[model samples]
Target: MTTREWAGDAETRQVTEVASERELRELIGEPNDRAANKIRSRLHDLDRQWLARSPFCYLATADAEGRCDVSPKGDPAGFTLVLDDATLAIPDRPGNKRLDGFRNILANPQVGLNYVLPGRSDTLRINGRGRILRDAPFFDDMVVKGNRPRLALLVEIDEVFYHCSKAFLRSQLWQPESWQPDAVPSRARIAKGIEAPDIPLEQLEAHYGAGYADRLYG
Candidate 1:
């Protein structure tokens, strides 16, 4: 069958697969000049500026067993403190206390961070080793709205780089005109599918709202 005919006939189409690094390289070839040269092992002045203006980041971590998790962290701009060229710190705010990220740090110190700023097409990526600290001087410096974070994640930088804008450009992430209307499922509707179908949704929502306002600070 021709390529188009093979695609059209589902029964004859076994998954087109590349099972090894050699096959992968044959398929995609090598990176060009800019792609091969963009990575940096240490933070630079421009990287610091990008991080300082960012209010949000996604943190990726894995436990000793290699179970992985990614969690969102957000606060006011520059909430993440660049302690030096080789170290950074992020405050831990109060939340549901699942501690998935924190627990992973204890078992496996390696972490990956992607910092994003609104309206900015490029993002900063950092790979590091993390440790949880409660040292008074360091933890006390992260006070927000008169509340100090009980813990802070101190990351020793290993690698840092600026990822290009292809992803955001393809998704039109910063274009309000291309956005769809908010159609988020209700908390109650989500809860019903999980573990608690019998409880009233109103009570769950009210409790969540109150906790959001009252326990937001750490």
Candidate 2:
């Protein structure tokens, strides 16, 4: 990603940052009734409808020490299993073996999820506790493209709400013209540069090439 310089002069920056809640609230006042009162302890009918159509979400988790990680999870629409009004199960898709977010969940059950749909400006936010399940009766329900997840993350809802579209509007995330997927470096080149200098560039490129998508379920 290209980094841009701050548009303001350095001299105009504030000398002291607003560190306290009082000072922070003074800058951005309290939320309105609609915003503050919209949180629900469990999923509503509409929330269920939303999850049924959402193909992607961001999973946020933190370890016991508060070190955080946010990972993107996606599948065909209705991939999330709504076990009950307060319970949800997300299949563990194949990906890098790092398991950063999963490791965080093992140490700290608390988690946050932001569900998004393509072209939608608003988002669904869920805060809950999570645990990993090696297998469940519902695993059959999570099958996709002839592959069933070996594990899944179960979340017990604590709070659920709809977030405003201010951030989405500001960033124009749904706009294709705003996208710069190659603004940084290609995945293969990046891996060869930082993670595997000894690996041949051709080999890395081929590993991340056209056949990459075929391995999504592998």
Candidate 3:
């Protein structure tokens, strides 16, 4: 595959530097002026539903140069391992090819997460320090999609917060009774873009069907 270009350029967004860590901490003392409610949260805050019911999550991380990648992971509820009052471990399942997110974690452990419920409006956001592990019992714990995951990532919860689901509420994310998939992007279209030297479209798809089950279940 060719190098993928970023959709947005740096010039598109305004960037500003906060003076210092100490200055930012000092500023957190004052309460919010927004409304009678919706106050900013502290580190120790833990919302139960955020951990218990989320079947899907997005992980965001960047390298030292600020080039970033966000990866999506999903499983049944309780797939994530709560290492403690302050840590979480998400098992890395099998994938098609790339390992961009895992590589970024090695370069910069600073990471962020957005956890969304299947049909719930509210979402949880967590920013934490993380590391990747490739050991046994840990992998065996979060196993799903059949085989044990080869690797798992652990994140120390430095911050935990939630977004009021105005966007989701308005869009009726919980109204799954009206949901629809956008489309099935064809392998031909994808191969035309990536110029993968794999095979003809029919053969490629057949290979996926025949090869995937054996690798995952064989």
Candidate 4:
């Protein structure tokens, strides 16, 4: 079916867009003092402390043409290296390695990060300029499970702040009762359905089953 048919008649639909900063500000109002003044150009002691406990983060990058990607990075707590108040480094690990975000960093240095700690509603956010390093003097310090990262993304901070937890609260993210893993297909089934239609479902299931965890760091 055509898009107009799928979305119903466009002329009869209420489609409103906030087109400019003036309209957006008029709708949401200006930020109060605390929210407006909270942006920082360097990481504070509190930010460092938060990084020490955060095991996961989402790396946001966009290429010169403005295509974007958000890649998830995780390790044991404190995986990120805080080189100084303005500089930070994230070690790379093995994966399918499409290198979408890394390629974006090559084309555009601007990057953003959202750090998360398990069971925590609030998040730490950073906006910075990023560069990829094949090797660094501190790489030895980033060793994990007998594996030393061969690459790391270094970021020079431009802004840092703690994000509020309202989204998490509204979604009940931390409440176990809100989880419904079975609401969607399993990983194997999903791979077969969307990515590998020709592959046998049983093979995909086995690939994602008992031995899957063993290949995480391999």
lDDT of 1 by residue, 1-218 (tens): 11332455446564455567877778789889988877777789998898889999999999999999999999889999988899999999888799999999999999999999999899999999999987657676678898788889999999888888999999999999998645766665677668677888887677555575665673
RMSD of 1: 4.6
Q: Please report the candidate that would top TM-score against the real structure.
A: 4
Lowest lDDT 10-mer window, candidate 4?
1-10
Weakest lDDT window of 10 consecutive positions for candidate 2? 1-10
Q: What stretches of model 2 exceed 4 Å from their correct place? A: 1-15
The local distance difference test score of each candidate is 0.87, 0.93, 0.74, 0.93
Q: lDDT per residue, candidate 4, 60-113, as tens digits?
A: 999999999999999999999999999999999998989999999999999999
154-176 per-residue lDDT for model 2 (tens digits): 99999999998999999999999
Candidate 1 Cα deviation (angstroms), residue 72: 0.5
Q: Estimate each model's TM-score.
A: 0.85, 0.90, 0.69, 0.93
Superposed Cα deviation of residue 57, candidate 1 (Å): 0.2
Can you write out model 3's per-residue Cα lDDT over 134-164, one digit (the tens) per residue? 8857676776656677788988877777777
- What count of clashes does model 1 give? 0
What ranges in model 4 sit over 4 Å off? Answer: 1-14
